[model samples]
Target chain A: MNNEMKLSFSSYSSNESFARATVAAFVAQLDPTIEELSDLKTAVSEAVTNCIVHAYRDAIGMVYITASISKDRRITVKIRDKGCGIPDIAKAMEPLFSTGGEERAGLGFSVMESFTDSLRVRSKVGQGTTIIMHKKLAGRLSGFAR
Target chain B: MGVRFVLKDDHLTAILSGEIDHHAASGMREEIDRKAGQAKPKLLTLDFSQVTFMDSSGIGLIMGRYRLMQALRGSLTVLDLSQQMKRVVNLSGVGQLVPLENSRPPRKPKASAKSKPKETIPETVEQEPPQPEEESRDIYSHSEWENQEKKEVMVHE
Candidate 1:
């Protein structure tokens, strides 16, 4: 089964939940386990948060998210923002590195990496940042299968 | 998200409910800190039984509250975390800093029973020595991070 979805919303903190929920609902068709679903939701939340907090900073921008499920139950989610980009992607991905000041935990990238099977980050100094993550859902035997 | 505080003696428990993402975490952090600071309790308990969902932002919330309690000369304990939430907390190495109390049931205040001691705060606050950050594993290579696929799709509003 193949499915895909795309969403764009303002970079408001309130929309963070919206983004993750939308992705989860779309992925629900694949019949993911509760733990798998939660992991995907957390990865989505972390990526969207980076867009809202780090990418846009104080200015309001738009966050674009695209999610798709492949035939083998592989889920791919792409989150993008056209705001201030990270100069050092490697450092930003570190466990406790945060440029968002004291209130921020700087664990966003680390969480995303750990939750998702694959994580890729691309950014230009002044352009924007894009995070792509992939997670494979376990194939459960259907009760109807002979 | 909402937080309900229950204060008995010098112990304060903040029962957190709803999803704790970045959006809700900031508000919850400010509220918890303000209440904990003003009360200056000897022990601060963060009850996560009511929390339905949490992300890395929850880690920040816990770490910040731990620092606040430390400044106030108090100890912090996390209670009743869901299994999924516990995974995120453990991944951040927060369990090493704050006590993750999930094995036992939460203490309830007795109405008429006086045999049990009223004191809830533990006599000794276990302080684990901070360990050095683990070296970055070769779970994935730097070249893998460089691989990228860009797709442009239009969304109809």
Candidate 2:
């Protein structure tokens, strides 16, 4: 569970999917069930998408994703981006609320919240935003540290 | 994105191939509406078999089709979805409207759904035969057009 891999890519919409797939493949060796894998991928996509759409504000930036499976059988993912930080996490997390128009459904945070067991966001205005999500994988936990 | 149509006895199957995003939605809408109307199918199936990728715009496309089918009293089904496509479709709640069916052979292309328009069907005739093309202006044209206009606005911005 201690294995950590990082990737740097432009804050493009297409890259969001790549980030999710990359993280999913990296953690697939942990023997997660098909459903678990799907959930993790969905969660990752949402997080990365948020970084691309909201944090980056249509500007070029790098998104760093780290995945680790803790001894407690918890799979942790942290998506960090050095872009526009969330000034009001509470309002941003509201369902059906989005800064963008109809193109953005504002459901990204809701999807992330529903998919993962534990979700947290740490951000500071004018700095950047970081999202951490955790899911409890069944069976033995990996012996990896974050 | 390319949309191929196959008309069976009473089903008009539209196989959506390639990526379905905002960029490809206008063509997809027109194609699906034309084929569905022409076939006059009792069941419309949107085969996602060859669809390599999809985004929220794809979800919008499916939802639009679902509404059209409902108005026609026809069932809509999806098939041949990648695991990622399945995840996105399921999350969007379209899975509930048109649940995925078991894999089946492609439908016959010659037997179109247009043969028995509801108005012409004989009384007590539930299943009608295939017919020729019946061109009808798409009812969703305005909405689809608005979407395109919005896209243009975004592009110009």
Candidate 3:
């Protein structure tokens, strides 16, 4: 894992897009296709969003995002936030089962799952939550910019 | 985002623009239901060409509208979906419920006789998508961004 490319920010929705854009740029070195890159961005957005809405709940918190290119040219992201952790990981993973008020669909995890091949969540009540996602890039595909 | 409706004869057109996340669902339902009941148009059109982005909550909103129109013996259609928006609708199986049509001026709605019930609060507030802009974006750098097409696993744990 390359440590220099990693970045961190406060957990918020606006910053979710920023994180996505930033990670998409860093992963450009892997020469990902448009669909592949979009997948990465969407996955990252979902994970970061979950942290902001469910974990921090508008409270001030820090979200860490790290992007690394594997030997096989895969892009990996680790999004972590120190906020209210998920009490029931199983229920939280269910589609359409959101714990938010009128303004949340609880589909963040589902969207993340749809866009990426691997998604793992680890959370402890009152501690924090960490989501690790991974995606592989096509070696032959090139010409993307960072 | 709040949606406005312009009723003309038998056609009821909803002009909507904004992010359709969980937060917008309630306002959308109230406005749409109110207009649909008042106009009782034979055709319901949801213009989305102006919408920038939408998520699953948007799907639920459309579904609620579809049910409302079906009760009124009217059909619903969406117009002017961008490529990404279209993909979202398609992926969510919304296309199976209401077909997409090319953009044109609001069509004349066929007159209806049935009166729509007063707007109620049955539809509860749902989930909201992450805001388009938030602070967690500092994770990646602009210099590292690459825009290439590669076929590989998108992500892993």
Candidate 4:
């Protein structure tokens, strides 16, 4: 079974929870464990937060998310933003290297990378940034089978 | 999300409830800092027992508060974190700077423990056992704070 979803929301901090919740709801059909679901939500939250805080900065823009699940239970999520793109993806992805002032822990990319099986970042200066992540769910029996 | 502050003697605990994200965290941070700064407690405890969901932003909240407490010469501890929250806290290495209540081992009898001092013990060890009467009285005396918390909850809702 293969399914996918696409969502676009304003780059407001309030929408961070909405984006992650929507992705979690969409992926619920895959019968993921509680831990798996939590990992996905955290990853999605981090990505959406990056878009709201770094990508759009002071202005409000749109953040795009596309999530899909494959027959083998591998889940892929792509989050994109159309705002100020990252000047250097490598430095941005480094742990504890935040441009955001004191409040930010600078662990967003690290959290996203650890939560998901694999993470890929693509960005072009003055364009935008895209974060793509993949995680394989444990093959648990469907609810009907139990 | 809202935070309810409880002050007893020189200890302060912030009971945090609801989903904590980047959006809600800024408010919580300010509130906690304001109260902690005013109270100047020797120990600050962040109570997450009621928190339903948290993300990396939660780590930032804890880290920021830890720094605040440090600057004020007070230590901070995070208590009642769910298993999932514990995992996130551990991953961020925030546990090294701030202590987590649930992750601690059960305390041994003082008589037996006195035989050997453990070097691995964290420097910010708990100060003293809580006194129930003093806590209750403090809450009763600080009715204004309760009212403030109620207003905060209403606004968040």
Candidate 5:
């Protein structure tokens, strides 16, 4: 089973929910259980929120989120942002490293890493950042998202 | 963000509803801080029973309140944490700081087929359904994205 898509939206705080819902509804195609759907939604939210808060900061930008489902029932999600990228990807991924200051929990990347099967970050300081996540799901509801 | 407050002497309990994200977090932080300032509660309890979703922003909201309490010489407690909320607070390291009313974390659903990781992040940063946007989104189906040639998957074997 094969499905894929590319979406681009303004990096507005309001769009955070929009982005998560898009990926959730699309990944629902693979007929994931409620638990699986929740996992995907959380991961997407962190990535998109980062784009709105840290990446774009005070300026406006765009975020690109893509999704795909393989025959193996493995789901892949890509969240791309062309705003100011992360300087230290590893430090950013740390559980307690947040640029949002004490007012921020800095758990964005940590949550992303924990929820997804495996997380990968690629970016250059001024170029942008892309977060890729994958997970092999279990079970499938017949005649769902077909 | 549907939040109401219950003021009981030295305690102010905030009953928060809906999924909390950056957008909701901002407004909530203001509302709670203002009311806490006016009421001057010795303990601010954020009631999460009605809250179905929260992201890092939710964590930030808690941290801010904790700091506010500390400065005011008060304390903060988060009560009625759902299992999903428990997992998040556990991960964020805030579960230890905020006194959870529930002694034991909620049990997760049983794993299916292969043994998946016991740890699961709530849907999208614990993605409960995201907040609504000004533009009405169309009813989406999986087929809308069927079979696009663009495929990018990064795996670290």
Candidate 6:
């Protein structure tokens, strides 16, 4: 299960859904259940959204996404943005702590955390931010890598 | 960003589908509010059973509906939620303001979910419903206004 695909797009809010749909299609080769695929799309949506709303706040930048199916049928996604970085990862990951004001529910990280098997974030104040999330598909493998 | 409005007995149910994000949420908030305002239903219900995914923007959409219902002195209830959506709505404290009906087990999806309505409903609900030509006030939130300003400044800078 070494199938991998990556794409980069502008950090516009409109592209959030596009990123989700594209990644879901790329990962469909794993034959994930409907719910599983939906969750993965939702998680990816949150990650890309964070990059657009929080990371690039009030501006536009480049957002890169990479999806890979590992040996254990786990789908891993990494969403990164070259914009403002989060200062506190722990605080940001809280269930209802959003820095985007009333417009934001602040559950971006929590949503990703809930939908995926594991959520990891690495960021620096003046550099950029990246979110890595992985989820194992439920059904048997479709063998896209080999 | 597909929406279908079901106007039942004194209740208006807005069934939202597809991926719900900030861009989609903005359009939904405006259109739903307008329709609900005109209908003035005794109970304004938001049906999320068809919604596959939503983000923080969803919370804002529901919260906006709650505020509009309050202004109208009408009750608001959210119904037919998937487990994932229920988590989002409850976590945002919207549950406290509006009673969320139908927990909706993982399977056995509800018949009322209405993934896509017939030709009776518009595809996107983009057109603003006819109004009495009231004073056009700034409709965007503070953050939205700030975003517009920032976009302009960034372009010039």
Task: Report, to 2 decimal places, the DockQ of model 1.
Answer: 0.28
Evaluated against the true structure, the overall lDDT of model 3 is: 0.69
Let me know the TM-score candidate 5 reaches against the reference structure: 0.80
The segments of candidate 2 whose C-alpha lies over 4 angstroms from its true place after superposition are: A140-146, B1-13, B17-45, B49-157
Worst 10 residues of 2 chain B by lDDT: B131-140
- Residue A47 of model 2 has an lDDT of 81
* Candidate 2, B1-157: lDDT as tens digits: 5898888799888988876644455578888998888877999888888876665555667777888999888888877666566656665666787867647432322222333343455654435333222213123256554544333322211
Count of clashes, each model: 0, 6, 48, 0, 13, 0
Model 2: clashing residue pairs?
A1-A144, A2-A144, B39-B113, B39-B114, B115-B130, B115-B131
Pairs of residues at least 3 apart in sequence or in different chains that clash in candidate 4: none
List each candidate's DockQ score. Answer: 0.28, 0.03, 0.11, 0.26, 0.27, 0.21
**Candidate 2, which CAPRI tier?**
incorrect
List the candidates' TM-scores in order.
0.80, 0.59, 0.62, 0.80, 0.80, 0.74
DockQ of candidate 2 compared with the true complex: 0.03
For each candidate in turn, give its C-alpha RMSD to the true structure in angstroms.
Answer: 14.3, 17.3, 13.5, 13.3, 10.4, 16.5
Cα error, residue B28 of model 5, in Å, equals 0.5
Tell me the deviation in Å of residue B89 in model 2: 5.1
Q: Hey, what RMSD does candidate 2 come out at?
A: 17.3
Backbone clashes in model 1, listed as residue pairs: none
Best by DockQ: 1
Who is ahead in lDDT, 5 or 6?
5
lDDT of 3 at A70: 65
* Residue-by-residue lDDT tens digits, candidate 2, A40-107: 87778778777776788768888888887655567889989899899899999886577855445466
| Deviation from truth (RMSD, Å), model 3 | 13.5
Error of 6 at A43 (Å): 0.7
